[model samples]
Structures are given as structure tokens and as C-alpha cells.
Target: MTAHVQQLHRVNNLCAGLEWVADCPNRLARKALLQLIGEEVGFVLEGVICASEQKIPGGRPPA
Candidate 1:
């Protein structure tokens, strides 16, 4: 649970940063912005995969 929570926190922070960058005019070129978004999406997916793979306490499945 701790690991899952930590990964989610990281993902959340990345999303916040992305939002801030996107809101800024001329912060990134169109291609660069798309690339950054794609990379962030990969990070989010990785977090989800990590969370799903985590073992729950007492051998119980995740809620």
C-alpha cells in the first residue's frame, strides 16, 4: 500500500507539473508538448501497473 500510494503521489505531481507547463504560453513547442505528454502518460501507466502488482496484506486482493 505504501509503495502504491507513493507511486500515485509521483504521478499526481507529474500531472500537476504538466498542467502548469501547459498553461504557460510558449513554454514548449507543439511537438515538445506532445512528446512530454506522451512521456507523462507512460509514467502514469507505469504507476498503475506497479500499483496493480503490489501484494495486499493478508493475501487479500485489492479493493
Candidate 2:
């Protein structure tokens, strides 16, 4: 598989795992989720905030 496809799979798996523990309030779990998504996809939600500051017109950030 291509690198992009593999990364997508990893992100999907992370989401599935999080769904299994939907009621937990553990900081570590949340942190891990963000880390996994970032590592696989190149940006977390927090990264989006930083990216918006760049002011790149017509740039749609990755999902």
C-alpha cells in the first residue's frame, strides 16, 4: 500500500479504539489519540489553529 493509504488506515484504527472507550475522561487517552492522528495525517486539530495563522488563501487543510 502507498504511504498515504497506510496512514489513513492507522487513523481509522485510532478512531475505532477511541469509540470503544467513549466514556473515559483520561488525559493520556486523549493525548494518544491526538498523537496518533498527527503522526499519520500530518496535523491535529491544534495544528489547524497554527496553520490558519499562515493565511494561505484557498488552502483547505487536510482532514
How many backbone clashes are present in model 1?
A: 0
Write model 2 residue lDDT over 1-63, tens digit each, in one string.
254455556666767766655655887887776666556445443354445644567766545
Top candidate, metric lDDT: 1
CA deviation > 4 Å runs, candidate 1: 27-34, 54-63
Write candidate 1's Cα lDDT for 1-63 as tens digits: 676677678767777677666766774574587578679768777767756756545543445
Candidate 2 has an lDDT of 0.58
Candidate 2 — worst ten consecutive residues by lDDT sum? Answer: 41-50
For each candidate, what is the lDDT?
Answer: 0.68, 0.58
Please report how far candidate 1 places residue 43 from its true position, in Å: 3.0
